[model samples]
Target: MTDTSPASALDQDPPRRGWPKVDKVWLALLAALLALAVLDRAQLGPSLLFTAQALWDILPFLVASVLIAAWTKATGLDRHVSRVTAGNPARAIGLAALFGALSPFCSCGVVPIIAALLAAGVPLAPVMAFWLASPLMDPQMFLLMLSTFGWPLTLAKTGAAIGLGLLGGAVTQGLVRRDLLGEVLRPGVAPTCCAAKRSLKPEPVAWRFWQAPQRRATFRASGLETGHFLLKWLALAFLVESLMLAWLPAESIGAWLGADAWWAVPLAALAGIPAYLNGYAAVPTVAGLIELGMTPAAGLAFMLAGGVTSIPAAMAVFALVRRRVFALYVGLGLGGALLASLGYLLWAGGGSAG
Candidate 1:
């Protein structure tokens, strides 16, 4: 028979302690990337040189990411984000999407914010609105895409991110009204992670660049942490990009996914569900695909789908929310990706498919 008393539980065991700070999954990922590098090398010397070049190309973005993270935290814009989303339903949803587009945080990084909002009694719909749009684009991503895909496609992609936010919010509003949110938040419970540790109290944002010693410390910590988080994954992404550019033959993407295939857009969207690529890394790879005959529509679809639902981001959501909410999140990501792809096809017309 098992002991069932509270005193028995105390005598039975104490909670395990001294957990490692580093995530094992991340270590495993690094190992996998290293293995790929070794297995796929065309020649040891050439591959090392190419990898160095790829790392150099991505270094600037890493610096920018760190700066942005620290600056955003210092300005306390996130407190405003919380305030906006907790307002009137219609207005809240619109503003949430708009704010989300401009947010500097990545999909996984934003998880803490989303969790905090729920803990503070923010509505599921507007928070969900922000959640759906936040990962797809940031200012850094926008400029990069503009330089790579040109003004037309880049603008359309940005528009699509906002549109998805609006659509997701409205749909979620309907669900909210009917009390059909499917346990997006557990009553009076906060997610157990970085979010649980941070104080979510609303504080006045200091406009001065270096308002206080503590603020400076916060900015430095946030920047360092954000930079460290981004660099490792980005390096892995660039490595994959280099490998694809080298090993993937011309016409491979276009051979099956060209504009001629009526089903290609939707299929590409589906493929992006399980495919993992960081937003920054996806740009060069997508350009390479275009050069190699991948339909522009297909590449864009992959970017949309994969950006919103990358493996790490999706896993973070799953860890925080209930199974039903996770399913809804995935559903929205796929639907949003398809909608954007179809919109692009109409806008770009026949010229993009070749």
Candidate 2:
């Protein structure tokens, strides 16, 4: 044992982790977690359990996310979708919003799909439409909203998602037509959802994706890439959630976003940008806020804002896209949230619900 054979020692050494250490995203997440850990331990809150439970709860979504990633790669559906829909703005955007509503994906979960669309040269308007709508009330989130809130709020959010999609699509259409559209995303930040296609040109390969070895490899690669990206962000988001829920609490949200104030709606939207968890996870908090006298209008705005621009989702978008596009995204999301709040307020004022 004392005879140190250099080759044997090297062989016994643990395999080094290289790429994750270098990844800015990974480093940022670790930093955030470390800070949160210190804060939580100091406060003597249920910080450890809170973080653990948050991750535990997110497991199901993670599995679904991986599957979505793999399938997106396997099908080459984005290419097919782009071929059918790219040229038609109205129809494509309408379809995108519709698809978003139908799917179970959250904002983060939709990143791979978003990447695929962008990589395939899908028009920004419709893609933005999908992006806008996907986070609001997907079928699963819709059900949760219904159970947590009520039919009126649920319908309001869904309609708002569609309306927002239309708004984004129209705005983007104008931008595209005027040749005023900036780059959709920076070149390098394009999410690595699949193997980079060396060309922007659409090359037709043999039919039947399963039969293609390259396609399978792409599927595996995309799934792993997507999983890695989503996991880090999700962990950060949940840690932030645990901290805010423990410290800020839902009752305070109602106080800050009370219906009486003219500024409440906008403030609600803005507050949601940093503090919002995913749409489904938001149910309990929203419910608490409503019970604590938060207006339905303010609640609606918060939900919309948080869904679109929550930290993890926004981070994913920012990493994958350019600044101008990112600004537009935040703009649309905030504007849409405000519109939803105002509309809901007006409707509720007409005595629509309890």
Winner by TM-score: 2
Q: After superposition, how far is residue 64 of candidate 1 from its true place, in Å?
A: 18
In Å, residue 329's CA in model 2 sits off its true spot by 1.0
- Give the CA lDDT, 0 to 100, for residue 131 in model 2: 88
* For model 1, the run of ten residues with the poorest summed lDDT: 1-10
Q: How many residue pairs clash in each candidate?
A: 0, 0
TM-score versus the correct structure, for each prediction: 0.61, 0.75
Model 1 over residues 1-354: C-alpha lDDT tens digits?
111112233445566689657855468556755776678545444645655775565455456645654655555544455455555899989988998888866665566566545544467888888998888888999999988988877887789889889998898888778877655753213322233224266457676748676667656766665555444544444444345445553234434565457788887786665555657877887777676666677777887887777655676576557777787888888898898888888778624432
Candidate 2: C-alpha lDDT: 0.70
Report the C-alpha lDDT of model 2 over 100-126, residue by residue, as the tens digit. 767667776677567656655577888
Positional deviation of 311 in candidate 2, in angstroms? 2.4
Which candidate comes out best when scored by lDDT?
2
